[model samples]
Target chain A: MDSRAQVSIEVALVAGIAILVAVSLVNINFERLNLARELGEGGEAKMVATLIATSINTVHANGAGFELTLSESKLNFTELTDVDQGTGIILPIIIDNTRRKVIVGRNMSRTGHKGQWNVSVSMVPNNVVRQDPTARYPEVTIRNNGTNVIVYADSSKVRVVP
Target chain B: MSSNRAQVSIEFIILVGALLVMVIAVFPYILKTNELNKALSAARDGATFGAGIRGVGYQSGSVEAPPGRIKIKSVILERLGRCGNLECYRFRIVIMMPSYYSSNSSYVNSIRSTIRNQALRFVYYAFNGEYPASSVIYRVNTNYYSFNATTDVEYY
Candidate 1:
């Protein structure tokens, strides 16, 4: 082929590839920003859940009755059972990604969904505790119960059970 | 014809060099803008989180922390200061709540305590302890649910 013809073909091919790469890059950035927004929203939900779990643990630790208001929060209570008078709830912060959920801190986890997190503050059994973190206080086990696409918080204090 | 080709090659090299320089110069600005935006979003979310927990102290009946689990009236951005840093933002947030009783020192003290503790925790979590923040609360009886009570929040 003539030299001019060869140069013309090379320029065309390079231009085509550049355009393709540019288009793909734009799409990638768009998706990234969308994910960032989702992360922000999920992070917000996780923060609220952690706050509730922390409140429960704090109340149990001090044996003091206290109330906290959760506003603009898309969270629901399961069983709505009070932390047992003697055995406070122990909540384990579980992080699972097969479900694509990230738990912030040990007590809170969130996913891409705008709303779908469960925090359980349950009574700890005396005999069946896989690991125990407390001797003075009746242990509370806070963790995700079942698979409701949720995370559970069961702790007399917000901590990992030993 | 040979001279023309040489001139064309030099032109292409110059064009490529100019593009490279533009990218190197502009990339930092883009990164800085993105970081600033992130900081702003984090601040807004943090303020909202703190406002949501304003009532945690009021659940007890006695002066046992004195908060019967209060309500947040409103949260607004009072001022914002921009500084030269990767995510530089110094801002003030104002929070309001309603007062059933007259503005008493004891009641105000409880509220201040509630705001300080809960707000600090909320910001710490929401911002992931990434920024330095300080909050101050003041309660004043204006009228019947006329958006009363206040907390001054400073974040850097």
Candidate 2:
């Protein structure tokens, strides 16, 4: 009602509005950063998936007796909170015969929430062996066994002995 | 003196009210613009990735690339029979993206244009300097957010 009271109220309202704006701006910035991070992770995962798909398709195209070994390291799985802890333990590649696609990313099973940052690429070959990695540095062997293409991950098979 | 002071106070209140009204009017526009920008970014990245995949497939029949917000719907390759001594090939690739809220289609159109150019380049190389007859057609179905490229090669 009084002049002094009016000025004090005005100051308080202005200060409150300024604080609100500041907080809102900060929150918006944080959201933007998180979105960027997610996009980057998804892009990386897709790249890895594409690489595996290309290799498998190439081997199948070359036909039987055409074998090529692809080291897991070539995939270059980037570390993310959603993926497995480290390189040695994580099995990062899966060939889905039913879907006729290849998925590249480790599944996250922490905190009872299961999800994986992965990408799937459709392939030409339908008959392909499904093999899981057993060793740390496994090399994937893609072979077209006349009728079906075989894909298996093995560390010891890095060198073939006659 | 008291009337003058009252007049100044009333004017201040009116000014603050007008400022509030303007802020409210522009807020939604700002948010919409932000959303449009995000959509454009995603679409740009997706287009680049898809073009890379098309390039790889042309070079070695193997495709390698990342998908940001676009997904490859299907890839079809038709032999188109034979062309004299050389072989003729026709391939179609479809990429799906999310639609944007804005009506300005220029952003997406530019991306589509870039993809068409890339397809032409791939076709030129596939012809292998023989100058074989080639056609690169691009169709953008906005309703389905699908971008399709059908490339045909026929020897002259």
Candidate 3:
């Protein structure tokens, strides 16, 4: 080939390689952003779940009932009632199945996917978990459920109003 | 010939500089993504396993902050350890039995609530995506208080 033709061929190869590298870098950047958003959602969802769980736990722990006002979000509960509490007369806890719930998917409950996370929380184990937190909880307020309110969070001094 | 060599060296410098920029910009993202992915995976697993934990964490009105005072009921905080590299947090369920009202219904209820709340916090934060596992169950408590730790992690 002539010198000019050889130069043209070499330029084309270098340009082709450069284009490939640029495309790959762009793709990796996109993937990182997408993955960050996805993981953030999961983390946020789990944080909401943890917040709700703490509230319910406080209620059951105090063995009293209080109005649990949560922002609109998906909620799931498992009957933490002592299966072995033994049949005997004792102080009654007013927590129903609704209040005792430890919600997992906070977004699903509020978003279009209503009633989608109705899985029986029967899977009991001790270990780590996967969470996708994307529930927007601007505020959590406690309301009056009834008399005999034992304990309350979201407050520095949680007093029981009997 | 010298002019041509100068142009080639400039090209080489440009390539090296571009590589350095790419490394500086992209490597941190890769490392962060890896850490986040690890955190998400561990959190998910912990949440699933923690769901079955029928326990609580209890802090006396006197205690302030996490790894504070864990009132002993069925829950017990063995020890609290800080992170050497990162800030690691944990729940230590101290075995504080208010002897005056050991049998009192209201007092027992108070202790019970403390246990439940503390247990929950332990699992939740212990599995936090950040930091290493520096928290340990205190040695003072026996296996009896671990409360079927195999299935429920009853470290109260």
Candidate 4:
């Protein structure tokens, strides 16, 4: 082969290697983007779960009495109303004492896909209704697409409600 | 012939151009991996801090705010998950504490109230997201008391 042909062969080899590297990098980036999205969703799920748990705690604290009844498709809070403090400022807001279903993809839409988000929330109450124990924790289970993440939060610690 | 040599050089140039295109296409993936690693580290740190605070609250029966408060915040970028948009994650740190009205309460109700108010300030500083100035409202019955003292967060 002449010197010119040799140069052409060398260029072709270099170009091929560069293309391969570039393709690999692109794949890596796509993977990373997906991870970031999942993390964001995970964060959202945790936030929602915390909100629900704290709401329950607030109801228990302000109410004359309340009951958490779990059903097959829903979790209900019965008798969930605060008594009139007589001061008449409506000290605590009266919450709806009804069973709320834990539906995952009820209102949220998935981006770039035909499938919707798989959402589920479960509550596990620690036994501290009658007694004033230092530990009163609620276990929350949030699931998305068969992947379940469990978070245990202590209402006393977070003190999200007044 | 000199013409043949010129043709060879042109081919070499074409090859080089193709290689450059490939590199440009792949560079994003490499950068994304680095970002993903950073996000994971931050998330783990926040999770650890949250867990630690809860542990202490459980053991000691009460936790105060500001100096004694434990706050954790984590963020996730758009490059990590299957989703394509950027998303921010925030958690309200929960610690086990003695009830304010209970006997031998760790802190006075006034002091606990101050702590609760300050926790949000710390959370705002930790995460880069928008939190609504107005408190989010929820509907509950008249029987339960709203804590409203825990951490509050907003993400856009």
TM-score of each model, in listed order: 0.31, 0.39, 0.26, 0.24
Stretches of model 2 off by over 4 angstroms after superposition: A1-22, A76-92, A104-118, A131-138, A154-162, B1-156
lDDT score of model 1?
0.36
Comparing 1 and 4 on lDDT, the stronger one:
1
Residue A79, model 1: Cα distance from true site in angstroms: 4.0
In the range B12-55, model 3's lDDT, one tens digit per residue, is: 66876787788779976765444333333332333222222111
Model 3, TM vs. native: 0.26
Query: iRMSD (Å) of candidate 1?
Result: 11.5
Ranking by lDDT: 2, 1, 4, 3
Worst 10 residues of 2 chain A by lDDT: A108-117
What is the C-alpha DockQ of each candidate? 0.02, 0.02, 0.02, 0.02
Where model 1 places Cα greater than 4 Å from the true spot, the runs are A1-162, B1-23, B56-89, B101-156
Task: Put down candidate 1 lDDT per residue, A97-144, tens digits, no spaces.
Answer: 333222222111111112222322232221112234333222232222
Deviation in angstroms for B21 in model 2?
A: 18
Candidate 3, residues A48-74, lDDT tens digits: the string is 445544654444344434445454343
CAPRI class of candidate 2? incorrect
Interface RMSD of 2: 18.7
In model 4 chain B, the worst 10-residue window by lDDT is B138-147
* Highest TM-score model number: 2
